[model samples]
Target: MRRLVGVLVAVGLALGVVSAGPASAAIDSSGSAVILPPDQDPFYVPPADYGSRPNGTVLRSREITALAYVMPIPVHAYQVLYKSVDGHGAPVAEAATVLVPYTSWTGPGTRPLVSYQIADDSLSTRCQPSYTLRVGIGSPTGVGSYEVSMSYQALLRGYAIVYADYEGPHSQFAAGPQAAHGVLDGMRAVLHHAPAGLDPNTKITLWGYSGGGLATTWAAEQQGSYAPELNVVGAAAGGVPAELGAMLRHNNGNLGAGLALLGVIGLARAYPESGVYGILNDRGRALFATNEDACTLDVAVLHPFDRIENYTTIADPIDSPQARFLIDTNNPGQATPRMPYYNYEALQDEFVPAALADGLLKDYCADGGTVKKVRIPFSGHITGEVQGGPGALQFLADRVAGKPVTSDC
Candidate 1:
């Protein structure tokens, strides 16, 4: 109880989210606290349980970003954040996706709210996450869309799950500060668009896995200055690389296999200032040609083991002093973090560097921000969301309930 109160006060001071109405017990539609019980399946719904459709007001799983095109198959009805217009009187593309599992509601309505969650990658249209079995795995196989799985889950829960492709159209790289803007905007788009039937002032929460974790961290941190009007009760994130610079540096040398190469190549493709092109050898250049524009997951599978092993020090011939400067600033420790973070990291992560995680956590702790770490005994480098998702959900659930997160596993 004390921890929960501390979270409210700390979050209010940190994000400046003023509570408007009386606070009540917060929770998702699901009655389960954190892990779903043995009888309940966390991901899928059985055919026998597909009963009558929800009369609740919700635009589930549909892509309403007003960007290029609205993706088909509304994931299901989730609690949306808000919506607004841009400077030119255009609709601001702000939104996030959410999934609510609830029991009998004593609240205002039966229909769940529209909501959103950010995708876990840098801004890129690359098809790495696509898969034959999964829609968002980054491979070109399968249905090649994430909404299908999201919709499948939402329907079973009788709630909506919003999928915020927060990378924006340009797929910006390492723009951590701008993360809050994208998240808030994406979430707002849903709230404003779907409030006719659902509650306009319904409770909202944010949760994410990996790259999405970074966005969640930034959104919570910058809630004070960005979209103060939105009633964002709590946000939960897992596997936070709190400091981007430290991440870059730690991964630069032979820390991990495909990760550093892919991350560096991706960042270089996004931000040229890191001198990425100059550091690559002929073999590295060939590899870059194949994957400079590829998605993170695609690089993980396609590149044979031999090609990934070549990822060594950023500067092979370290005698030259110029390369040293490039190496120094890329570490996560050197980069300054800009927001309050619900940070989590894996202890034996093959993708994320241990040194980077340690340094970033130290800094965030010093800043008096809320830090939640879920140390995975297994390596979650590949399927980060699958591994860290349950914990992420519970963390956000606590925050929305106005509780401090004590589940630091």
Candidate 2:
């Protein structure tokens, strides 16, 4: 715990909250200065005519040193800024980091691609995997940096991985369609890049938990329609908030309320037409302004057990017409995935109710979609990710091997 606190203090110092110094500066393995955060980086800016380019077209490319706890990993890493569509189908530039192992693949068929989504439950571009996975001072505090360790497991297995900033340029945290487009198009950009050396016919699988799970499931549901040219074999989503409204209600006025509020901000960013900001009172507006660029740790640590009604003008803002429309539009399970699906949930999840996953799987099965379900006993939202990860990985392995999946539904 002492070491953890020390790391947090160091992060605070780097963020300029505790002390002032050369912020956002860290030495890479090559002894060069690391790239600036996305907010301050020119690479994140897309060309004005990027909208005229095809979806998934690479706008910018840069080679980056991948890191694991400040040490450089022996792998080839590249970040691509690609064109994608937002929730309303407007052109937007999204970023993704593609990692290829130094070791060659000895597995069946060509090398497999795993689009691993990191749970970037933050409102800052600095929290995206494209920035966080690089060797830099900000990496320790970047939300995706910790989860990139799990992507290394797939890299060890000779699977090329792409970590997309599925939240898009604005960091729309819970907006589903925008995330889906970003994930699918990131895969497209990776395949289109010649230097990546990935086969165009690479079998793809998706894995993520919590907010990542939300993005993975959204991509899985929309892949058939949005990017049917790509070969997506299977997907594994755990600790999923399958229904946005249900999750908001479950977490309101509880320990997860701060995170829930972040989701509201994200939704408002994705759909300004919903008028979420207009409904906010002075306190709500102030809190939103403060946390608009906050990382997951900032929200989780600073605003636990918060009540939305404390800041909003309405007693039940979630039940308002705009909120209802946002919820209905973003919720998954309206369509079934073309490939096999694996879902895991915590029976006692506090942030997202298990019944939502249960109902989603049931609906998928009824729609003739291949589905696998696992329920972790005595686990809450966080522990469910740890306990369910191995099973999810195994399920992906079977799909990659072309093994038949048995649907529990």
Candidate 3:
């Protein structure tokens, strides 16, 4: 609790979100006391039984008016709180926003489903896409997550959308398996949801970039073995940090360090056995504690040239066995996906090194997987999202139509 408070206070101070609220400073939510200042609204906490339910079991649901940024489409939306598993296979409740266009599918057969995972790279639940998609206000703390708006294009393409919080109730950020489960199970929830009118065997495609890409890739890998019943057509992931260890090495002392550290902190949240706090030295521990509740921009802009070594007690902090295992365990591309994949990366990506995408593609192809690799020129990490999103959408359209995908590798 002290650690949680310290993180909230430090982030509140740094983000200027410290203010008194109508309720008490601390309120119990799901057995944890969350410090809610006036500037920061508390995110939804699922009930204890949520986790005990079967994966994809919808506990409760309500129809919501989903407003897209520039699109005037009357999107039929529903908020679903469904059962999901964690990295450890423990039960958890996760929420997803399902948006169905009023227009019918112009293509053949059933309407295609796009499980869009936004790049919700934050430890704060306020930044989750489910919260940001509503009409009321943006992220409660004003972190400004606009990725949900990007889903507008998918809606424009007439694809039924299932956007999961992905990070689960705790905002497990970069936790691979946890995010993967939320995504796959969220798809399950959307498919089984009676109001959505989706075919139980609908063609599904996973799409995301950066953090979202990590979740997409992980889900693609886990689908064949984890949830084999879901008919996933394909997956498109761009600017994926396939290996967190490689990401740490690439971002250390660079502009991406702040956002990169969030992944480290996230890994700690995901894998308690990894000893994130145990590995950190005094300065590292303090830094980690201060940024506990920090969002993507808060971390990225605040400490641009930070180095991970400065926070650790040992000479090679990430080189330890525990750290290595944690990173490797979360990294994707080891498990060959059962479907064709579209992966892209910018050659000049400043945040995620292109080599990460290249390595994943190479590994997937070597395992007899059909993969299409695209290298976006004259783009950096952030620009790659804009360049890659449309192509991924097109790929999903083709895949959903049962088009044969020829490998670009």
Candidate 4:
């Protein structure tokens, strides 16, 4: 296994794919001069027998300082590589960052676990929270760094938080099953880690907004079947893109077209049988190659108000049979969540229509799931996170406190 990792590292360096930084470079609260990204980092590579390990089994772990943007957060932090499954149920190693606050848990039960999913709406591994939350490695200007503030808030409440790279190793953004498995397995890994001093039976609440919301909700729905042993009590998801097809249709040629395209690229990665590359025209191929490792802001700035037809050979690639199948397979709401769910949506959201989330909650409710729905009026996609966070946090807090919740279904 060590030999395999060394060979991989050598190949990466030879190809100029990995960071060629000094090994002795000091890693501190203030950003380091050079830090290896996940693709090049040795810790991310699992052993040859990783697939033989049980799901959520920790493959490797290292202590690191957690950071909210550039400032070092005073907490016990560790990045863990664990075994998980992809969208296809194949074993895959995933990464997650676990944070335990200095202050002890004074809450009713064992310190609650908040599996905080950051909205990594990018095609790049650099956007994963496991990397971005590390000191001196994360981009201070990136969205991942900004979202770390929410994790900081949870840490302040003495809640142990696990920020999973729920998008998986490939950064398979918007791939529902993969994301769900990653989040659940990450929670499993953290709960089992001895150094964190967490009870194995700790109550857990899932929380996220936007892309993160999609992952949280998926985990909520899949936990009943995929990770039934998890002690998840509730989930709070804000600004969810519940239906991917609807999102792509809503954003086509609009300001969010680039973001939608990124989703298409991600889906292609997750389900290669979708034949996205085969249908792409020259322009589409070029765009795919260029944005293959791009972050959310990069796509948002580069391809806003762009049309899908401009890149594809077919007039409506999104409506094609392959795309439709992928969409139906990935979309949430088909299954009922075993635990209570809180969903908040921006009524004026442009990227994801409010009606899609409404329909999703309606279905979940009709299927006998407990759901609380919040509609934020006069707020769009970006502002809805700020407006909806407090209520979501309170919902999580109530669940952690063992407060009885009435279904707003």
Candidate 2 lDDT, tens digit per residue, 3-71?
655676667656633323222645665677757777778998999999999899999898888887668
Instruction: Give the Å error, residue 274, model 2.
Output: 0.3
lDDT of 3 at 387: 84
Report the error of model 3 at residue 2, Å: 29
Q: lDDT score, residue 105, model 1?
A: 38
Q: Write the per-residue lDDT of candidate 3 for residues 124-154, one digit (tens) a residue.
A: 6656666555532323433323566656687
| lDDT by residue for model 4 (50-142), tens | 998899999999988776655778889988899999989899999988889888888786988999999998787776787777743335225
> TM-score for each prediction?
0.58, 0.93, 0.87, 0.92
Worst 10 residues of 3 by lDDT: 19-28
Give a tens-digit lDDT track for model 1, residues 79-157.
Answer: 2323322212223222244433334334333434323343435223322121111212212322224423433433354
* lDDT against the true structure, each candidate: 0.43, 0.84, 0.78, 0.84
Considering only N, C-alpha and C atoms within 3 Å, which residue pairs clash in candidate 3?
284-311
Q: Sort all candidates by lDDT, best to worst.
A: 2, 4, 3, 1
Candidate 4 Cα misplacement greater than 4 A, ranges: 1-34, 135-141
Name the weakest run of 10 consecutive residues (lDDT summed) in model 4: 17-26
Displacement of residue 142 (Cα, Å) in model 3 is 7.5
- Which consecutive 10 residues in model 2 have the weakest lDDT in total? 16-25
Q: What total of clashing residue pairs does each candidate reach?
A: 62, 0, 1, 1
